[model samples]
Target: MDGPFANRGRRWPNVTVAIIALWTCASPALSQQVSLPPPLASNHATDPPLAEAMQRIEQLEQTVFELQQRQNGGLIEAEAPICFDAPTAELPTHYPIYDSGWTLRPYDAAKTPFELTIGLHNQFRYTGFSRDEATTIDAAGNVNTIPNRNDFDVNRGRLVFSGYALDKDLGFYANIDYSTVASSSIQPLLGWISFRHNDALTLYMGLGKVPGTWEWQQTSRYTMGADRTLATTFFRPSITAGMWGIGKLGDSLSYTVFVGNGLNTLTLRSSDLDTNFVYSALAWWEPLGEFGVGFSDQEHHDNLAIRVGHGLTQTKNDSTSTDQSGAEQTVVRLSDGTRLVEPNALAPGVTVNAFDVWLYTAHLGLKKQGYSFSSEVFMRWLRNIEGTGGTSLESLLDNGFYIQGGAFVIPKKLELFVRGSAVTGDFGTGSEVAAGLNWHLFDKRSARFTLDVTDIRDSPAEQSRTGYVAGESGTLLRAQLWTFF
Candidate 1:
């Protein structure tokens, strides 16, 4: 009985002590912790819930990220993609029109405008011939003595004025040539009026003395000893043709056509007889890209000249003239019929009525990196020139050809060129070799130095008879200082 009471009293005391300890420590709810989202601010309690603040913070972070992405060149939310730099171009912007973008207003016909562009050009040339001494047969069938070794001294100076009408529709350009070579006088080189139509077409009406080949971009072909070619010197007409036209047709084609007095016959006079009208046409075809073929023709009352040239090969065909003689024979009596002749009739001096002639030219060029090498050949034939009697067409019919080559290298502000040319025809055979250096200073202005030699090949008797550069076959040399402004 005593042990039972002792046990009860001990259990009651332990229960009382456990209750006291719990009350002194803390409440059970208070001891448990609640985890809230990341703190919105350092001054606020992080143990509580703040849903609205946390949502706002999340939105702000997203906005910042989006702005950064856009600044770094990213696609925007509602915009098209963009590039920083654009692509480069490869082709030219505009096509080149031969004589375009230079038209003045107020088109007038009679009252022509004038622009004076004056400059001086000069050159010196020496020609040598081989020595030949022979006897000549006169009209009386008599033989005569001859001299040898003749040379010629030549000098040239020119003033040029070329421009367009300032307030009119007409265009005029002229050059006055002063030289010791030919009849010394200021001769007009180019004077024409261009009628404007559109961007690609033009009509030129006036005097035309320009050579068929002198209009090429390369000036070397035309600048032969301050003139053009020897063939042009001998066979070309003066200001006898008129009503010419030239135009650019397409991106790679151009043409020229004219109706003029081809029979005006080139002379040193300002006016001549209007013998007959001649028509000329030229067409250029660019088939191989940078290479072209040029076809030209001159038709006169009783004569015709057809020319064909190649841009790449620099070669031309000059076999247009054909024999017009028939299979027949005839007899002739001289004015002084002291002697009668029944020869083959196909004699050297017989004259025919009319014949066709062809001229061909070809060019071979090596162009690389601003350097150029080129050559040309020109040939012509007189198929027939028969008149009547023993005075046959042979004396009237003339055929000739020429060959030329040149090298243009070391291009800079100043350039150097060397060229050689030879001409052979019924008149005689002559050659020209030239070396030149030029300095380009400003617009259409340049200074140059040129040296050249010319040779004439003629029979001993023929040269002596002419009394020109007689019977000497060699080259004459010359030095010249030239300028064009």
Candidate 2:
């Protein structure tokens, strides 16, 4: 289709017809014009027919000589312009880049500046719960009840669409999840339009995850357990409409800072939100190379690797609180599982309406051979309490921590892990210990089966998704098969 002289013959038909007009008689080739013998040539260039034909032949030879000279001069002046293939130029074509792993550019991106990628994450779970007691008391002197469950569930059937437009640095993302546990059967989660200046910095706007803790920083698809830890659910910030900045200072250091509408306004309308905004920031460093997102030693590092991180978040808002666990549940909870929104929660007759909260957290993680160890600590300070009924309230403080470790029993395929966590606050103290086994179906953790059993006492965490029931001691069991693409 393309060659230096591919057009060499395309421009000659018109030039040949002009040469015929110059001749009194029709002749398509110069050889025919020159075939007339000298016998036909007479005095003064012979007969009129012969003389005219000779003149035309001479002109044609000159034209041929000029074209040859032009070709030698490196210019094809009569050639037609080059063009794209007709079929591809008019029709759009696409094929999967991998149909697995990270979705990369697969839309014949060089020809089209816009790209759209689709992804999925599926998790099927089986859980069993048994409470030590039917009812338990909280710091507020209120009795709370527990419910037991044994069944199967889905996360449920999450779908993600993300890509870039105009430029690779301009990106967009949208996620939808359908599950019975969600506030609605189908709900939109995080969605954003982002500008990535470089690996060192990226800015995003829209409903996004607040950057407040290490556990929440990594994707849920790569969790070391079937789900995040109970302590993480208790201390971490929830999804909110916000703008955030994320960047890496160097090969080992990364950071994120966010400002959002409220601590837990995922389902709230603008009228329901307060005037105050929540601010959260976090930074982590992996000194010995990349410490991958997951806590599990799936990599089986030949040498030691470590990561350290710190985070802080502050918020003061007039958000309604609830003891129930749902898609948009209240984030600020008492150690003994009492909702700050509960009437007379802090005093005999006062109803607390709002509070200012500050949380500081730190974490350390280590990996070597086929083993991994990680831990995080959280401290919270709540002040500026607002209430009804003219009852004065005092500040409150709370603290919590979780430690986890794992080692592969069969190279990279099977792993044994143990985890424990505890919480202490003005209201009460609670804790849990758990053990699990993981069997990776593929080389990556993208496909896996996990099983774990946890024993909890006066559980402070109230996240039902993580199998925690506040104010009630219990033995919980979970098994899940999860995959991502």
Candidate 3:
């Protein structure tokens, strides 16, 4: 125990000296050299010990100031010149000025630029048949005549204008169309004014064509076939010569609305025509890549017409002509003969009012890439038709559906497109198959070739005989041209 005590005592002294040495070496502030000006250099300012102590305090204070600056988020100047060529100095911070403008808004077309353009198109078509048949009756009410059907006929031509007006905000368009190949003679197709409010908003109004499911929906303007399923004709007035509006809801959705005099005066009865009250609406949405849904509607008045005819000879005579019912032919015999008549048998004053026809239609289309699937159905009812003898009457109902599939080989520039349209209902009409090819001469002008085989009754299940004609089937071929500047 005595020896252990003696060794401990010796260790304590050495340990104490080691602690003192460590304390001195660890203090950078305390170890700093403190200096004061010499008495002679300082002009005999103060005692040397006093100056040294003051200088030490000053050095410690300077070190504390620097530490505070670093803690207070202060940046220190580099001791050496900074080299911009260094990787650290070249690091990206913010977008360059040139790129900043791009993220704000699209360049305005109205203020930036404008253009003017015009276009024209022409086409001809014809149809041929192997056999023709019609029903006829002779003077005694006995029927035994077959009239020959007329040969094929054709013509379709168009002119259009488009592009910008004023600067960019305004747009102008005009189109003149004529179709001897169509059911009608000549007509002004489209004319309108358009305004661009923003990238997602556009407004168009004035006399113009309405873009619907079948007519203006095709990328190639020319390929559509004639005998446009009866439904197409019924729906045309809703889409043509109307006041229409369209709006886009973001990038995935769009909407359209229109109001017009349904059908037209020439086609509909005078009583059914609406001078200003006509309207339609459509909306479409695409949530997935290539799938879409749409809805539309159109309304018009009823049309009714009547005719009467009685043959006096073997030849067919006009129901409204003098030979059949002229007032001048009236005969009056006094009491002896006991025969008196107020008017002739075929008097023009003897008017006949016939059936009233009413129509309604709707359709849908699903398209993916180059392939498309579409379906349209419509119905018409004819109420009360005066018989051939103005004394009898009949009622008829007509309805049908058109389902089709097609592919676009060249997108909008050119395409070989075809569709199979069918009809069946009150009219006793069979299904039809149609095919065609279309070509674009310019972005807005195109030409088309088409062939359609209709009323095919080869299959007993598909035959619909109405009795008005005697043929089981017929064919129509067409070449058409269309353009919109």
User: What is the full ranking by lDDT, best candidate first?
Assistant: 2, 3, 1
Report, for all candidates in order, the number of backbone clashes: 33, 0, 7
Candidate 1 lDDT by residue in tens digits, 124-220: 4443333444543322343445444334433446665555665444556655666555544555554566777765777777766433332232333
Question: TM-score for model 3?
Answer: 0.47
The prediction achieving the highest TM-score against the true structure is 2
* Cα TM-score per model: 0.50, 0.79, 0.47
Cα-based lDDT for every prediction: 0.38, 0.75, 0.39
Candidate 3 residue 315 C-alpha distance from true site, Å: 41
Tens digit of per-residue lDDT, candidate 3, span 1-485: 46546445434543443344334334434322323222222311344643564454444343433332322222323232222233332322211112211111112333335555556655554444333334322212234333333344434466666667555678887767676544456666667888888756567776643343343333233324433443343223322344666776776566665655442322334344333333444455544432422110000002211111110001011122322322211111111111112222113233222233344455555554445555665554444433235653344455555665555566644445556544444323444466665554542233334444444331112101111122234453444443332
Instruction: List candidate 1 stretches off by more than 4 Å.
Output: 1-116, 124-156, 166-169, 214-239, 263-274, 285-366, 389-410, 413-445, 454-456, 459-472
Sort by TM-score, top down from the best: 2, 1, 3
lDDT of 2 at 466: 67
Candidate 2 Cα outliers beyond 4 Å, as residue runs: 1-88, 91-93, 99-110, 319-329
RMSD of each: 26.7, 13.4, 24.6
- The total of clashing pairs for model 2 equals 0
